[model samples]
Structure formats: C-alpha cells, structure tokens
Target: MSPRNSLLLVLGMASALLAQGPDLPIDPANSFKVNLPGDGPLALVSADWGRSSATARGGAMLVDLHSTLVFKNSSPRPIRGVSLLVLAQEVTPGGKASVTVPSLDIQSGESFPIRVDLRLMRPLNAGSGALVQVGLDGVLFEDLTFYGPNRLNARREMLAWELSARRDRKAMLSTLLQAGPEGLRRQLLSVLARPADNLVMGMQVARALPPTNIDPGRVVEFAFLQFPDSPVELLSGEARMTGTEARAPRIEIQSKSKRPIRFVELGWLARDEQGREFMAGTLPADLSLPPGAHSTIRRENTLRFAKPVNGLTAYPSAVEYADGELWVPAYSSLKDPRLAAALPASGEERRLAQLYRRKGLEAVVQELRALR
Candidate 1:
C-alpha cells in the first residue's frame, strides 16, 4: 500500500479504538482490525474487542489478542464450518494463524460466534494499522461447497468434521426412530458413561525422535483391529522403539474398496505394562492410491509415547476419498467394547447430549429434525 493510504488507514483505526469506552487496557494503536469481505457467504454482524495486550520485550512486541466475532450466514445453505485467518505479520507467511470452528449447523441468516485467541511476536516499531488483521479464510457449507481462499486447507478438515457429525447424528436419529425416547436415553447414557479421553502428560511431538534417553527396547510389530466395512487393509508395519520413544515408523497398506483414497489416519494405540491400553494419538498420512494399489506410509520421527508402552497397535480411524467425501469408523464399530476408552464421544453426540441436558430432550429432537 502507498504511504498516503497507510496513513489514512492507521488514523481511522486509531480513532475507532479511542471511541471505545474509557479505561481501556489496550492502546488504540496497538489493537487489531477485523476485515471481512462484504460479498462472502458470511457477513460480519458485530465484533467485540475483548481483552488484549501488547507488551514490549527486548526489540519485539508480544501481542496477545482475544475477541468475539459474530457472523451471519448470508448464504442459502447451512454452514458446517468456518475458518478465520489471523495475520499478525502481513509480510511473513509463518506469522499467520488460523482458527477453524467445525460441526456447525447454522442455517440461512443465522448468526454464530467465533472466538479468536492469538499470541504473536513482531518488531516493536512495526507496520501501519493494528497489530493484527482478522479475515475470513474459508467457509464450508453442509453440501460440501466451500467459499473463500483455502490457504489453510480448511476444505478437507471441515469436510471431515462434517462427515463425522453427519454420521453420528444419523446413528442417533436412527436409534430414536427405532427404539423411542427411552432407548435413545439409554444410548446417550452409555455414551456419557464411557471413559473420557485422557490427556497425555509431558507429551512432546516432533518430526524426529529424541536421540538421548534411549530405552533398551525391541522392534514392535503392529497389530490391527479389523472393521467390517474398512476400505483399506493394513498389510505389515513396525516401529523402532527405544525406551519410551518409537521412531522410524513404517506401515504398508492397500486400498480394498472401489474409491480412490486420498487421506488416511491411523488410530495409534499403546498398551502399558499395567495391561491397560491408551490412545497414542493419530498418524496422518497423505496418499494418492487407487483401488487395489498398495503404498507404504513412512514417518521420519519414530514412535514417541508419553510413557513406556508394552505393545503397539493401529486401526484405520478415518479415511477421505478423492472426492472430498470421508469414511469414519462406523458408529457401531466405534462402540466396540475394546474402543470404549480409546475414542471420545462423537462431536454430534456431545452436542446433542449437551442440548438435551441444558434445554431438555425436545430441543435435541428439534435440532435433529432441522438437520435432517
């Protein structure tokens, strides 16, 4: 931008910040700006400049921003997800951050909320305008149509979330249709009673495994839990283990179904010495394999578990086809007794149950109806 335009833009932003109520903790010049395209599928309804700060550290500025942005779905279809791009350093590509909210079921003209919490580091005396600029990166509709520049690959991620949400919702709606309210209650109770996802303490994820603190470990051959409708087959795989870390992992698999597979995620699991199994995060690999074609998925970083694992196993957790469609473990498959503690409640399940708890059962029924 030219210097004349920059001066006007900065002055306008400063004046707007000063117009905010008094006793402001954030300096006007050090604040951020919201820039939403007027012709997009979503329209900015309001922006609340919530708590924010800019502290000088050495020759740089530490900017922390927290804001609530409300947007209306101006499109004709229901929105499944929204991703906002937060640009803290316009010139530096790495300084960009993205916030994506998935599993949304917003209808036309419906308003939704997005919370932006970001921390950035930039030169103390930096560019014009606010310290950050928030703009729309993408929006995924219920029909799989996407809007905006997909700079962050929001299309695939949003579609995956939508697919999962739809699958879980269909299962729940079917339960209600077949068994009535009592049966549905039993199902929700079972889901709510399952063990919650555990947080692995001191888990450090890196592209490569640590060299030191090696455990006198042996090679671990992977095992798989077969799903009836799985489109891919795991042939063979193993990980090099050293004490608590596993590295140089490799797995071979072949597509068994007709669809062209594009993305694969393995449900990595580890069994501790105490005879208990815990989820060891997912191994995501990009593939361009057709039906009956085999490929090897390799990772440079070896397997690093939060704790010493006695055994390791994997299963196809989710898969995406080349057509932007997804296939997740069947709701029934995920309900297996062995997987009860491994996977958390589905997004739709948690959402419906929360609605039922807060607003009663009828609200959930209405929501399911609207979704259908």
Candidate 2:
C-alpha cells in the first residue's frame, strides 16, 4: 500500500482501540494529547468557521468551515487519524446539535485539511442569540499541532493576510503610476480601497458629476482618485455609554472626518492583565456627505452588552469590525501603483504579490466572532 494508505490503516486501528465503552460526548474542557515521532508534547489549534448564508448555493442556509491541522514529529514514528471534537452553536439560542464531515485524514510530520458542512436542521422558533462550542478529543502519538480561527491562530492568520493585501496594493499602485496620470493614479488607489458596497454608489456619483470644463480623462481620473487610502478611518472618535434600552444597553461612538467618507467604524480598545490591546467591538455605519467642497463626516454606532458578560473571545478586531460594519473590501486596483510597488513586477511574482495585500490578523477573529 502507498504510504498514505498505510498511515490511514494504522490510524483506523488506533481509533478503534481508543473507542471504549459508550462514546461519550466530546468534552470541550479537555486537551487532546498529540504524540510526535520523538519526545515532548504536540500542539493543536482550531478555528471556527465563519457563518455565511449559503442559501444561494444550497437550498438551505449552511455553515461551511475550512480548518488546517499541522503535526510536528519529535520522534521517528509517524502518526495519523488524529480525531478532534469541534464545538458548534446554533444560530438561534438553544438550537439543535449535529455533526457532519465530508472527509478527514492525516500524516505524521505533515498537515491535513478538514471541512465541515453544517445546515440548520429546523427553523429557529425563538432565541436571543446562537450558541456554539468546540473541544478536543482522541489521542496523538507524538507532538501534534493544529491552528485555526481561535485567538492566537486568528492573529497569525490576519497578519499574513494583511501582508498579502499590502503587497497587492503596492504592486497595483506601481503599475497605475507608470501608465496613468497623477489624477488617474489617485483615482485607482481610491477605488482599490473603497468598500465593495460603496463601489457602485461611488461609480454612480462619478457618472452623475458633470465633467463641465474638465477633461474627460481628468474627470475619469478624478472619479478613480476619489477612493480612500483605507476604508473607514478614525479621523477623531471616542466611545461612550449613551443609554439603556429594553433589550440591550447602548454604547455610542462619534467621529468626524475630513473627506466625504463612505462609512465610519467605532472600535473599542480593551486590554487584558498583560496590557495587550485587543479589539472589543466595531460599529460601521453610513455617513452623510454634503455637496460641494470638503466636509466633516460624523457617524455613530451602538452596541448592547450581553448579560453574564461574554468572554474576550466574544469581541472582534478592528478589521473585522470594518468588514462587519460595512462592505467587503473592493478587489479593484489589483493594478494600482501603491500596490504594484509593493509586489513583484511580473510572472509568478504577480500571483505571490496578490497573496499578501489582503487584511490584518485581527480581521479573521472578527469574522469568526461574527459567525459565532
């Protein structure tokens, strides 16, 4: 048999041996031990899938997940079939529970990928919120490691995505700078950074604006240049507890901007005992823009804290808040100057360049939190 198949057989035998008595529900509190090839312990990481409405593709709304598991061997022996218990909550409070997996397998000193497809078994009748949980199960012979949407994993993921996005942005900017005029370059940058939802609106505005005495090229350039350095900057803002509501208390944030901004993001800065600043929550809302000349855009966001107080994992980072607060980032200007400069000029360089200019590490956490 092939090495992979051989490993699978070994794992199946191991799982059967580990399966004793009635299969108890996986415990969320316990840690799964990973045995490596050599000595020491294995590390496991898990990320929850971000919940997205899959109604368009599937008849019912479904939750899709992609998790990466990494196993490092400390000894010479190989390992496989590392069973893991995942915690999932219903979208509605007190929802039903079920588990489904398309496929699962692993190799020693190697990584494996797992996907979970979840669908709502029944309609949520009544509930304030949803509940999900994940835990560890099974055994690892040597040192095993896993990474996913959890706090640490999310941070690492976001940082990687951010680097990619920045690289892409730089490469695109470079190309536009070489081929287009100053105005066009600016416009390209703007469109690249504009929120996905706002792109159409911004385009509509560009079309409506009378070129008048302006050159058509320049007008096009102006429209393109209107994109921002980044979506939803905190020009000057602060968060405050405004009032109490019947459902949840309200927290308000007010901010002013120099340009005709598309949206405003209100982020809460909180730190643990270690003084590490983690994002609390983000509120994204549309800002009213006045006609003619520059204007200050003012906006507010309201958040109601949950009773019994959810833990830190409940909060989202700023990048996630921006996405949740408004629209997805526009993939435009994959051809702009700032983006181009940061990326390779050609070939596989283009593909590699596109990978790094996405978003930051915290954004992944926020997306996962939203799923929760």
Q: For residues 1-372, write the lDDT of model 2, one tens digit per residue.
A: 999999999999877655422222222223112222233323444433433221222122222333333433333444322333443333543223322221122344544444444443223222222323333233333123322223212222223233344444444555444644444334334444543331110100011222233332110000011224343322222222221101111222222233343334332323234433333344333444322223232222223332111211211112222222222223443334433232223221333222333553233223323422
Q: What would the TM-scores of all predictions be?
A: 0.84, 0.23
Clashing pairs in 1: 215-243, 246-302, 246-303, 247-302, 247-303, 248-302
Task: Give the runs in model 2 whose Cα sits over 4 Å from its true position.
Answer: 1-116, 121-259, 266-268, 291-372
lDDT for 180 in candidate 1 is 85
Which 10-residue window of candidate 2 scores lowest in summed lDDT? 198-207
Off by over 4 Å in 1: 1-30, 90-94, 199-204, 209-216, 369-372
**All candidates' lDDT scores?**
0.78, 0.31
